[model samples]
Target: MSWDPYATLGLGRTATADDIRRAYRKLAKELHPDVRPGDKAAEERFKRATAAFNLLSDPALKSRYDRGEIDADGNERMAFGGGGPRPRQSARAGAGAGGFGGGPQGGPAGGADAFDLGDIFSDLFGPGFSGGGRGYGRMRGRDIRFTLDIDFLDAVNGAKRRVSLAEGRTLDVAIPAGVESGQVLRLKNQGGPGVQGGPSGDALVELNVRPHAFFRREGQDIHMDLNISLTEAVEGGRVQAPTPSGPVSLSIPAGSNTGKVLRLKGKGVGGQGDQFVRLLVMLPEVPDEELKRFVKKWPKRDQAPPRPS
Candidate 1:
């Protein structure tokens, strides 16, 4: 007796298509050949999982197996070989019965009757059994590749997102902290279905971090531009800057220029890198009449430039 595909996969006879898919995915993840390369035990488990998936994935084959018309290993039942129902005969004496038990002359039971085991096998297990009893052989499912776009903040802070596949399956993927663009996340056993009891493939997710308008990443460091008023730039003051963690106060030096950068230590993604804030000093727009009057009497510096004659 061949191994029961359903039993090998740990699925019931009434398992639905979705149930079969879920089981295959779970098993493939646990028994992927590449993941456990050089390990004989894992390889055997992978083979068994693949076989179960192949048998259950096909509607015709699954139906036949469920009806007991085919063996668990996908071989045709012995009773089907005689062609329909045979005349009742004692099991012990039937082996020696001559001429297919008194059939018409030169009929299906006569000397001219030739039984092609290949034809019977083909009818039972589809055409082309080149692999002997190894069952159907075909390409496994294609490996799936897709990109997941995550917010910069989320990438730094970690987040959970739901991803949908073309097969109408949605999976919840957790984005780890400090993940960068072009990073690949492998979800084992989420790829295409295998054929002939072969293992399914995998789903590979490429991470793409969306750029933030205000925050930028430099290695593990976080960079941001801080807008400061003329008074704050000239007088040097404490300003609030945004970091991956949250808003934090940063000190600005007196006479700070438009391009001066200040670093806040250990305020970045993993709290191991620094946060850099570049100052952008904004001058006040043309003053109104009341402000212009006050500025007209403001102190002015007297200076002279030396020119070579």
Candidate 2:
């Protein structure tokens, strides 16, 4: 069947290189055999998409295809955009070295247009061809990319995660400390197998860090809002605060107010970054009668409340 690479990729001929790459990656993630195991329809779609990507991703091949010099399968097409077989020339005009007409002054046959049909055929047939054809050299396998979701704390501190791959294989990916969302971790020689003893491709794992309930990270620093009772804000005392490492005793200053950020050094990411705790003063859910009476008769201060730091 005649294949249209652009249609297979769901793109127009005017799509840019980046567009083609993105389209193929999206399709690969959805149609990969590993992703949709046992789905024969998806497997076939994956094969077709991969084949189209292989051809369209090559600038030389893509140019030739755009110019109608080659078919979708990379085979040479008939001259002048004709679908019929090429018209044969006279025996004398075609008879020469390897059946190619000689160039002017015996420079070279067909001049700049000359190319070895044997090499093109060899490329099509691959290295396994044993019918007196030169085999294509060893080639490194293509790299594979996939996304992995991890806990927020795992991203702050280094962690190892096991991921499954094609062919029932698994990989242990080491996530480094302070890894952010969209960061990639590459595992060498963990992707597709190489051809003809060539080196294998690498596996690229793109991380998606799950958000924490109370913690937010900025660079290496961690920030979180902690609720404190009004008495703790006014009288000051030791209170427990959460950090990326663990809970720690925090000394609240007297008269501390909301928006006051306290720094806990070496408690953020990998024990290198700091954790900032912002205090939010909270009132009692149900005020007692005695406290209400005391508040009703309390004198108003002449000075305004201090601004939070």
Strongest candidate by TM-score: 2
TM-scores of the models, in the given order? 0.52, 0.58
| Each candidate's clash count | 2, 0
Relative to the true structure, candidate 1 reaches a TM of: 0.52
Residue-by-residue lDDT tens digits, candidate 1, 202-254: 56667778789998888889988899987898799887778888887888899
Colliding pairs, model 2: none
lDDT at 63, model 1: 69
> In model 2, which runs have C-alpha deviations exceeding 4 angstroms?
1-136, 301-309
Per-model lDDT: 0.60, 0.63
RMSD each, Å: 21.1, 19.4
Clashing pairs in 1: 50-197, 51-197
**lDDT against true structure, model 1:** 0.60
**Model 1 misplaced stretches (Cα beyond 4 Å):** 1-140, 286-309
Question: Lowest summed-lDDT stretch of 10 residues in model 2?
Answer: 99-108
Cα miss at 261, model 2 (Å)? 1.3
